[model samples]
Every structure is written in structure tokens, then in C-alpha cells.
Target chain A: MKAIEIDNLSKSYNKGKVQALSSVSFEVERGELFGLIGPDGAGKTTLFRLLTTLLSPDAGRATVDGYDIVKEYHAIRSRVGYMPGRFSLYPDLSVEENLQFFAALFGVNVEESYDLIAPIYKQIEPFRTRRAGKLSGGMKQKLALSCALIHRPSILFLDEPTTGVDAVSRSEFWDMLAGLKERGITILVSTPYMDEASRCDRIALCNEGRILGIDTPHDIVRGFDNRLYGISAKNMFTLLERARAMEGVVECYPFGQRHHLVADDSFSVEQFTRQLSDIEGLEIASAEPTIEDMFIKLMKR
Target chain B: MNSEIVISVRELTKRFGDFTAVDRISFDVHRGEIFGFLGANGAGKTTAMRMLCGLSYPTAGSGSVAGFDVMREGEKIKRHIGYMSQRFSLYNDLTVWENMRLFAGIYGLNRRETEERASALLKRLNFEAERDTLVGSLPLGWKQKLSFAIATIHRPEVVFLDEPTGGVDPVTRRQFWELIYEAASEGTTIFVTTHYMDEAEYCSRVSIMVDGEVRALDTPARLKQQFAAESMDEVFRTLARGAQRGE
Candidate 1:
């Protein structure tokens, strides 16, 4: 059976003034690692809430682990773990106390769930006596993940779990998730960072309350139809403007310290170089499209 | 390039009893440069920034911002600098124009000057249509950009951005960096803290703090070469591997 199945899901807020999600459809196979990639206000959080049974959808249907989201919310809730984008742990309680509290809510003891959380819990175990509020950003996230996994759910829903942590912590967090996936837990995560999308088995690129594209990260980049080139100069701002004004330039935007330019059929590297020869310190080369490039193109479309 | 040193520190230290949140860190930030401060969540980055921004007193060591001693001239440093964070400090209940006027007033701008600057800023950001709209209704990216503009409204010599691009989209992030570059070009020093490694690459220099100490500091390219890594992400991992805070 599929881990998750959604057909034409729709939701809105403020008496329909804001359409948070509009007829979205997607499915996740059992034991698959899926990602919901998008920017803020793209309805990623709404979708997570709906799937986790915290909020009801306005239209359509979804099933988590063969349990209907609305009618069988109790079953769905028992079978899935959720970590909200914002930190929700009690500040006054110690790290250990928070974990014990969450486990108790699920009618389970920390000892019974210790094996599932061992890899993560061990890291924060040294600070078990410290107040949850006193823990650092990375430590807090690790603690939160431990709480989520205490019940050993069949699937996990993590909403932007690495949004504010440092690069090392982010890498470590993903590693933990990958380890959990190895034990056969289906995972669905959402993030605004495009680079994180590549870490998932498959991802749905979302924007403006809609799913623009859904595929593996490799397949998504492979789908870009235009030839891309990386161009740089002494003055990036000037280079961006000039590249945008050039003929046969389909799209151009700043990427890091360089400008990523997409070209039309008539474009050639030599011709482009000759066109901008007057500008000093110019360098251009062919480049591969990243998830960010594809997202920009999809948004424009 | 003979750039002026806007900020300098020597063995900066902050201690809360025995915790030692910031441990003798040292660095320098030059005028018209984007200096990135990176660290693990509890690695003492916030503590260090607090000392430099004059929000908290250091237990030991010394530092100066905008040529003013951090120990005795915090108020002066505050006046010469602007700050923006992930959670912007704008009044959401107020209109865009009202927010601008309020901030300008706080910075001691006269009424006529406030109106002129607010109008010009709105036009420059293509936000004229939304001047009367409530800040709460604007998109996240738009609101962040507006917060940045307001932070620099006084035209301070330096600005501190605390994860300013958090949760923003890639396209909007690039746009935000354009604003950063524009400000730097006009001689505003940019001191930023971020978790995004790619963003670190855009900085003129970056310092990685691990366990309340600066583990590495250099330009992105030089750091990458020194660490023998392909990207900033790997370089960060190599430096932060020995951290004691997070297992």
C-alpha cells in the first residue's frame, strides 16, 4: 500500500480570501523519502497540517498509511510523527522531561522508545539536565526530532527542520533522517532551500499555493529545456544588466558571485563573447542547471 | 585596496558564570565589505554579535565598532549602525508608510525629511502601490526587503543582518543580495550571520565559530582551498566536526 495518497487536495483561509492550497495531487510510496520544496506562502505548511490531521481540507481526499485523513485521523495520528517548522517544546522543562512528556502523550515510555531515538538522543544526552530553552539551536532540533520519533511511527512529517541551524548541523540532521529511512519509515519533508531538495529521493516543487513540478532532483534538473551558461565579470551588477539586455538571452539572474544566463536556439558562446567584448574582465562558460534554476524558470512560466 | 577598518576585535570573551559563551574571538571588518559570521546554533555566534552590537557586556577582552570602543561607547556604536533579523521588528498592524515614518522618527529624522525619504524609498523598491497597505499583508520576501530598507533608513555606516534570508525563496534571496551589494557599494559595511553556505560564498570573508571560538577565517575560495573541500558546506563540516555542544 502507498504511504500517502492525495487527490485534488484544496484548502483556504480567511473565508476563502487566501487560497493556501489549490487542487494539489501527489502520492508517496511506502518507505520513500519525499520532499515538498517551496518558498514561504506556497502552502507547504498547510499541506503538512492537513496530512497530519491538525486541520481539515476544504476539498478532496488524502490517506496516510491507508487511513483517511479526516474520518480516520486518530489512526493516522498514531502512525505518523510530526515536527513543526517552529520549535514547540516546552521551554521551562529539561531536555529529558520534554522527551518523557511527549512519549507519555502517546501512551509510551522513553525506555520503550529508547532504541529508535538512540542515535539522536545520544548527542543531546550530555545535556539531559539542561533546560530546553537553554539548549542551542542545533541541540534543540535534535531534541525535537527525538521527541517526534519516541512513538516509532511508520511515517514522519518534518516541516523545514533545518531552516535556521548552521551548515554542519543541517548536514548532520539529514544524515539522521537518512538513517531513519533505512529502518523503513516513510518520510515527507518540506524546505525552502533548493540544495536540500537534491538530498531527497523525490520532491514536489511548490509555488503560490500550487505544485509546479514533482520528480527526483536529478530528473527535475534534467528536464530544463534551455542551454545554461555561467558568466562573470569585475562588476556583477553591470554584467547582469548587460547579459539581460543581450539578444537571444532567454533569462538571466545573479547566481552567487556570477550570473546564470539561459540562451535561445540562435545563441552561441563565441557570438555572446564577441557581443560583450567591449566589457573588460568578462568570462563565460557552459554550466549545468541546478534546482534553483529550474524553480526560477517554473515560476516565470 | 586600503579599505578602512570599521570593526576590530582582540580576544573578545563573554562568560555567564562558567559557561564561557564567547571565548577570546578576534577579527576585523573593513568598510564596504560583507563579512559573514557562521557557527553552530549554540556555538556563541549570537553572544559575539550581541557584544559587537552593544546589546550585551563582555566578561573580558576588547572590541571596537565604527572606531568606538565597545566597552564604553555602545550608545555611539548603536547610532552608527543598523540591524535586521529573521524576525523583522516592524509594526505589522501599521501601514507601510506608517512603519517607515515611525522608524525614521525613532532615528530622529525631521518630518519633511522623513516624508521625502519614505516616498523615495517606496518608489525605488517599486512599493509605491503598497504604501498605504498594512505590513502584515505583504509577502514574506517583500516584508524582509522593506525591513532591510527601514533598518538602513538612517544611512548608518554599517548594518548587521541576522539570518535575513531565512525561509526566503532563491529568486528573492538573489534580489535581497542585490540590495546588500548596492548598500556595500555606497560604503555601508555589512556584517551578516547565516546558516546558508551558498550565501557565505557571496561574502568578502567569513569566520566560522565552533564551540565559542573562531575555528577558521578567510575568503571563501581560500578557505575552500585550505580545507581541501569543493564547497563551503564541506569546509564548514570539516571545521565544525570537533564541536562539543552538539555531540
Candidate 2:
């Protein structure tokens, strides 16, 4: 079953000065962990806003759980859970109070929905008395997740769920989402982190208010048709400039401490290393291309 | 405990009207090191950072930044450090190179240094061809990259980046941090705030902020060990729960 569907979706703000989304379309299957990968102003949030019925599209339409996004807005709201990127919860309320309030607002009692959030809520249960604003980033994220899941909506929309937390919190949050998915919840998450693309079941690499490409993470990386090499040296900057200028080199951008150089022509590691070594203080080694590489190459075309 | 520390705060506090935005917090940033400041929303990360950056004054206690007393030398600190906000702060009307030149003038860089550094920075960002391209015409990631380059063009002693990689793609983020590393190598201390956990792993040391307090400060690996987490994300969740330490 298609959990969510968007068709001919277009939206704009400021009397057309801002084209937030444009003729976008896609479908997410049941129980799929679909990711909308893009940077700021790529219409990811705009799409989320439209899907959640927070805003109406100037053109196009969408559906959540077989209900029209516009006509059945209230029904859709109750049937789907959403966690916006920002911490929008009331800071004055305690952790438990926030959870209870959200539960009541959704017309669900904590006792009935407790099982769904057992894992995450358990960790934060002790901090139940702490004010929502006083809790840590990771804790607030968990609290928000639990609140979103309290009603057990079949579809979930998480807009940049891991944006501002520590690395550990980010990982744990994904884990909780995975667990939620296993319980038959279809997940649609948007993130700016390309490395996070692989964790999704399928991804749509988006930019400039358009969807560039949509495919499985493995397929995206496999689509990178070039020999990638990592090079470093005493004079990394000078070596980078020279490598970028090398013959048959397509792209030479710094990756971590090493320069991830993509060859325009297929070249052996030895030849690549030798070509780099000719530049004083240059060092090189074979390397693999990441999702970011695939996204940039696809964007170029 | 070293007197050479670039930043030292003793029981610093901040309030807005009736709300205590930053609770009493204390931490010292070294003279030359990449210090990662992280927190969830409303965790007092922004308030704490504002106090350190001289954008907001503390309500209580005192501190020092870069040898100048933070309480009385806020102006001196601003001249010696570059700040890049999470949102783009550059002039959209100006070209990429023009923005750099404008910021260069703000730092009092001579015409020669401004021109030379603008060219160098644009080249490093792979936007040399777009030197004349209006900042508004560029993508968010590109704008963010250029902002960082321009911020550091003045070659300040420190750079304060508040959520620099918030909405940027991973590839852009990787390049952004490289520039930061280059600046650090040149002996410029980096006091960066971010929500991206992986970025925390790259910092020489990280401090997790919550409720206006420094909850955790250490190497990523050490925090991982302390939290029994295999990755930075797990470490963050574990600590974020304020889970009692087994030891």
C-alpha cells in the first residue's frame, strides 16, 4: 500500500517571489523508511508542511493513508504523526506533562499508547519532572518522538530529526525510528546529512526545489562511474591544486584530511599515485566514493 | 587550568527579562583548539555562545576571551574573531567576491589583502568563476561555504560558527570543516556550535550543552567509551538521558 502520495505539487510564497516547491511528485510504500535528502530551501520542509496540512499548496495535491490532504485535513492530521525540525514543544511544561498534553490533544491516553513509546520513554521517564526546556537535546528529541508516536499514526513525518543533536543521539534516534517502522509505521524523513542517506530504505536526492534522482542508497553509490582515489601530503593545498589540474581528473575535492580525486578516465592506482607523487609533497591512495560524491555528480548534469 | 586558555568563565549566567536563559555555567576554551559546542534546541547553547561571543552580556559572574576580559573587552574580542551564523549573514546584493571584500574591510584588511584573500578564498571554494555572481543566485551550501571563507579572510585569532552545517549537505560540510582545520593549523582557535553529531567526532574536543551547563566535555572517543556507545549518536543519547554512570 502507498502510505503517502504527492502529485503535481507546486507551492510559492511572497506572491511568487519564493518558489518553495515545483511540480514535485513521489510515492512512499507501506513501512518504507523513505528519505527526502536535500539542503535548505530545497522544498523538503515545504512538502512536509503541505503533507501535514499546515499549509495548502497553490497547485497540485497529496494524500496520506488514502485520505486527501486538503479535504480530509483533520482526519489526516490525526492519522499521521509529525515531528518538525525545531523544538516546538511548550518549554514551561514538564517532560511528562508535555507527553500527557500531546496525548490529550491527540485524544489518546498515555496508558493505551504507552507500549509504542516504551523503549524511548523509558530512558526519559526519570526526567518526567524536568521542564521541557530544561531537558537536553537528545532527551527532547526522544520526548518529541514519543509524543508523535503516542497516537500510533500509520505514517510518520520527521523533518531533519537529527539536525542539532550529538552524534550518539542522532544514531539512537534513527534506531528508535527503525523500531517504530518495524511496528508497521511508514516513515518519511528528510535530512541534510548525505552519509545518512544509506540508512534509508530508498532516497530521493533533491535540490533547487526539484527531485534530482530517487533510488536505493546502494544503487546511488553504484551509479558513481569513476575511479576514486584519496591523496594527502606535506603540502596538501598545493597537492590538491595540482591534482585538480591533473589530466583526466574529473573532480579533486578534499575529503577529510585526504583529497578524494575522481578520474575522468579509468586509471590504475599505481599510475594515479605516480601522477600525484610527481608533485612535490604529494601522496595518494585508492578510495571509494560516498553518497555525497554521487549527489554532486548527479547535480552537475 | 592553564592561564593561557583563550576563554575562561566563572559561574556565568544570562537572563532575558524574567527567564534565566543561561544557567550558571563554566568552561575554558584553550588558545588554539577546535572546541565543539553542542546542544538540543532551548538547551541554552545559544545563550551560552552569545555570552562568549560578546553578542550578549552575562547576567552574573565574569570571564575572559583571547587575553581580553570578556566582561570589559567584548569589543576587543569582536575585532579578533570572525562569526558565521547558521543563517546566511552575507549581503545577498553583493557578488561572492564582493561579500568577501566587504567583510575584509570590516576587519580592516588593506585593499591588497582584501583583493588577494578574496581571490584565494573563492578559488579554494571552487567558485572563482562565479566571483561576480550575486550571493542570492548561489545555492544555500555555496552561500554557506563562501560565508565561512569570508569570515576567516580577516585571519582572526578565533572563529565562532553557530550551527555552520545545519542545513548544508554532507559533502559541503566535509569541505567546510577542512577550511576550519586549515585555519586551526594556522593557529586560529575554532569555537564551533553544531547539531550534527558526526561533526562533533571531528572536533579536537567537544562540550555538550544542556540547560545552560556544560554537561559533557571530552574527545568524541572518550565520550563514546564513557557512554558505552559505539557511535557518537548513541553516546549523545546515552548522555542526553543523563543516564547514571555505571562506574
Per-residue error at A220 for model 2, in Å?
2.2
TM-score of chain A of each: 0.98, 0.94
- For residues B1-247, what per-residue lDDT tens digits would candidate 2 score against the true structure? 2235777888888888887777778888876688888765566877788778777778898898777777777888888888999888999998887788788998899999888888888777888899999998887878888888888898877789988888876567777877887777677889998766667766777887665567888877688888787666666665566633210
Flag regions of model 2 displaced more than 4 Å. A266-268, A278-281, B1-75, B87-138, B153-155, B174-247
Q: Per candidate, chain B TM-score?
A: 0.97, 0.90
Local distance difference test scores for all models: 0.90, 0.81
Every model's DockQ, to 2 decimals?
0.64, 0.29
DockQ of 2: 0.29
Q: Indicate the residue-level lDDT of A150 in model 1.
A: 94
* Tens-digit lDDT string for candidate 2 (A1-301): 4899899899999999889999999999999999999888789999999999999999998999988888999889999899999988999999999999999999889999898999989998998999999887778888998888899899999999987554545666788888988898999999987768878999999987899888899887888888888787765556777776767788877664466888866556666567666666666677888788888887777
Model 1 agreement with the true structure over A1-301: per-residue lDDT tens digits: 8999999999999999999999999999999999999999899999999999999999999999999999999999989999999999999999999999999999999999899899999988999999999987778888999999999999999999988767777777899999999999999999888888888999999998999999999999998999999898877667887888888899888776568999999888888889899888999989999999999999888
Which residue window of length 10 is worst by lDDT in model 1 chain B? B238-247
